[model samples]
Target: MTQSADEGFTTRQVHAGSDARAARPRALPIYMTAGFPFDGFDDAAAHFDQGDGFGYTRTGNPTVDAVERKIASLEGGAQALLVASGQAAVTVVLLGLVSAGEHIVCATHIYEGTRGLILDNLARLNIEVDFVDDVNDVAEWESKIRPTTRVLFAESIANARNDLLDIASIARVADGHGIPLVVDNTFATPYLLRPIEHGAAIVVHSASKFLAGQGSVLGGVIIDDGRFDAVRSGALYPHLTGTGRLGGSSLAERHGGLARIAYLRETVAPRLGPTPSPLNAFLVGQGLETLSLRVQRQSENALIVAEWLSTRPEVASVDYVGLPSHPHHALAGRYLARGNGSVFTFTLRGGIDEARSFVEALRVITHMTHLGDVRSLILHPGTTSHVRRTPEEREAHGVLPGTLRLSIGIEDSADLIADLSRGLDASHPPLETVEAVREESGALDVVVAA
Candidate 1:
């Protein structure tokens, strides 16, 4: 129905990118073509020079573009770009805007994989990243900002851990400095939280996760808010400021509102070489058809599971925005429309070893590194995802050795809770030993006590 112009999210999800015909297929057709056929020699030149409307798979694919357009409409973005993975989206976005000398102010609560990409992989490229606690007073973010600071990056719902960002407040801080606020909305997804509506300048997603609704595909999407003025800040973005080095012309000149995403597709995609496979894009497209339903079901199951975990004697604390006790509970209610999300973290009565044991003991929940799967999955961030970090670094981001990140699935809540209870029974350490350790530490004020 051509983006609906005015329709509910479910309606938009079903009809946004489809054109019904007299012979409408029940399922979305997979374009699955590597290159588009050109009209003529002049048409080929025009297509290559213009660099839009799909030339090659590396440049553009119809299936990927269809998904990108659908996501853009869903997230209220002017335009969007689909990439191989969420990490690629961030890399292209950063490289598109910031040069080697530039710096980024990122939240400490970011996903461990993203943290590694920014600090480890990107560091070798001369990119500097400064991480601040998402809950730190707003002044901390401002204090970290420097003359070379180019982007303010955060996660709408901090991955694994459920520390939620004050998006509007952060957006205001970013606006006062004339910077763009980039939010990784993977965990929240657009169904639960639309960051653009809250002043985020750009929204990125690991479409491999909840957006795909299953673990069958790997995809990423970057959606542009179209609010940043490239002309004014073009110096920080060379591909935007300079005469087109990658392509004939810079995206800033060709597509003003979509400058960043366009540049990412045409200029950076060729160099970064992180385009999603047509097969993966097709799977994600199928997942998008039922995104709302899966997200809602997952969220509801998560809330019940979080509550059950909190009541368990073997559980210490829960890190879910849905719970009233969480620090970001109120903010979550305001931002997340559907629910707080299926991925949440909790601590076992014991420490890291016990957390690992619990994961091993689980009967129903799969022990895996990935989240947002159709089947319930459990992970120990300290050992699995954040194993690269030292104990000090891990604690700085609120990941305790005993912390267990649970990605509650669409399974019945009762079955999920029973499965967790089995793990909890297996994981809790001796009560006397725990008490002795607490006494020896001589400080009960630690955030990890739970």
Candidate 2:
């Protein structure tokens, strides 16, 4: 009833971890059981003491395992774990790595919920996070590393803003320091970029977005690449290296090739527990089937929209890595081999009011907080997603008052462009498309048509 990553992408998406019964219904069924039956006390002990397969929904379930395997295979990782929401995934992963007084280095352009998770929730647990601005500079990361630093985290393609992180550079830095590199590939997804292939040790995803491809489910997933030397670096990760908390089981022994995942499932997940419902997992798995097709169309439409926005006078600056004008465009060919993801940001010529008006004037795109759906969406991070941060902090991370993030979907390019054109005209009238004169501005407003 288990499938491996060696299968094709579409094939793995459809058939991975699915049994004959799955085909009988022609759909993934939800095993909505809270607990599994055991023959005797010893059987229950064997199931819990050592994972002798399925036991309980909280600990593990067949439905969860099916989706986990599918995602792991898709991401080219050794194992996977599913959780309730994107925040839950971040919380569980961070808690598993660093403890009280430990430190983690994260990129400044992380999602607002994740940034708040680091600032508020993890801080409550006494774990500290140092947000670094220069993600591409390995030396800058090296400067932040201290004896207490436990992990290096960044997003492959940021949520709302589109900037490509130099994964190989960051991974090299993490490798040099013997710390695991965690890349949140929520925006890029495995279809466009698998961080593990670029030397990342682990990959995290907000399955709610593109992986779900609909605004229905809220789920998250963590993929373990199974390459980190956790046991060798005992001094840094005591929770994994010198642990005797869970019935005297050493982290070194219990979690080895897929150790992080094993540790998460057996020890951390049980405590920080936010298990995904079988129904949600099934929904995500179903979404995974058309991931390539959906994202391809989305990316194509996104590039067209980014191009159209760049030509408009109402737009101040556009930032999508697919454009050759991006600072990270050179690395895009290396990192995102398949496609540049569909989420990106552009600032209006007018400030917050113009941005708000532009978003409100939109007709086709939904005015919502969510992304990666069959329909387009737009939001202003300064007021909505990143509202928790002060103006100073927002500016520090390139989040300006006029900035508008777009998550383009599979709609027709002309329709999307027309919808955006209507909004742009309403925001700043009497100005034509800045095609010729704006070329010398050198701001990142390149048109990425096709």
Candidate 3:
């Protein structure tokens, strides 16, 4: 079925990338080949010169292209590039925009992988990064922005902590400095928020997470709004404004609005060789078909779970943006009206020992680090995801020894609650405490004496 540009999200998800006239394969077919056959020398020459046809899978693949188009449509962006992983997407976008000696200002709270990439990998390449301790503080973000700053990076909804970023405000800060705002929308997904619509220039995703829904594939995408005009922005991206290595003209001149995306696709991603497999791309597309359903159910389940945890005597805190007690609940209400997303963290009163016990006691919830899976998963951020950081650094980002992250799934609410109850009882030993109370009251002691 043909889809209109104005179709609703779910409708677009199902039909946006479909070519009804071409073979009518109801599902998107995987073009799992390293290279495609060329018609002749002329065709090969044309493909090379214009970068039109998919002569090599690394350059492009039909299956991957379909997923890219669907993701672009979903993100409300002009173009999207699918890569091997979320880390690749970050690497390609950064490399595409900046050279060695340039700078990036990023939100402090983000996925540990991305934090490591900026501080370690990008640092090794001479690209400096400054992290904004408070993303909501426009002045703090602005203060970190240097003349060499090419981009402002942040996540739409930060992982585990559920710190909701003020997208429009940050985009404004980026624009004031003539830089682009690049946001990782993996946690929020396009279902909850479209960063482009909120003024972000580039939106990235870890398609392995919520996008794929089933946690069966590793993929990533960078969606360009086609708005960050390098030529106009001036001095921010000399790579784009300068003559291309392929030797015609600058990317800005050649691709205009699509310069950044074109540069990444033709130069960065292909040369770096982080191309996603066509099969993985196909799985991501399949996941997109039910993105709305899974995310909505997961969000609902997370809220229920968060609320339940908040009331428990053993819980020290619940870091869900959906909760009224959360610091970012108002911001969440403003931006994430659809839902607060399923991935969040909550702390236990008994610290790491109880956290471990609670996780070990869970029967229904799997004890794993991965989020956005169909099955509920739990992990200790202090010991696992944030272990590299010092205690001070971890505490600054709200990752305490007692904190346990939960990726709520679409399981029945009652069943999930019951499972959590059992885990909490094991961790806190409420039954034992009650028995002690009864004995102190002489009720259990007298019965035992008789």
Say which prediction, candidate 1 or candidate 3, comes out ahead on TM-score. Answer: 3
Give the deviation of candidate 2 from the true structure as CA RMSD: 11.0
Which ranges in model 3 have alpha carbons more than 4 Å from their true place?
Answer: 1-22, 431-450
Task: Candidate 1: list runs displaced more than 4 Å.
Answer: 1-26, 245-250, 429-450
Task: Give the per-residue lDDT digits (tens) of candidate 2, residues 110-169.
Answer: 888888888888899888888788678888888999888989999998755577899988
- Considering only N, C-alpha and C atoms within 3 Å, which residue pairs clash in candidate 3? none
* Greater-TM-score candidate between 2 and 3: 3
Model 3 error, position 123 (Å): 1.0
In candidate 1, the residue pairs with backbone N, CA or C atoms under 3 Å apart (3 or more residues apart, or in different chains) clash, namely none
Which is superior by lDDT, 2 or 3? 3
lDDT of 2 at 29: 72
Clash number for model 2? Answer: 1
lDDT of 3 by residue, 244-344 (tens): 56667888888898888998999899999998999999999999999999999999999999999999888899999999988889988789988999999
Tens-digit lDDT string for candidate 1 (154-252): 998886568888899898888777778899999988888888998988999999998897898888889989865776767766666567544555567
Would you give me the overall lDDT of model 3?
Answer: 0.90
- Compared with the true structure, all predictions reach lDDT values of 0.82, 0.84, 0.90
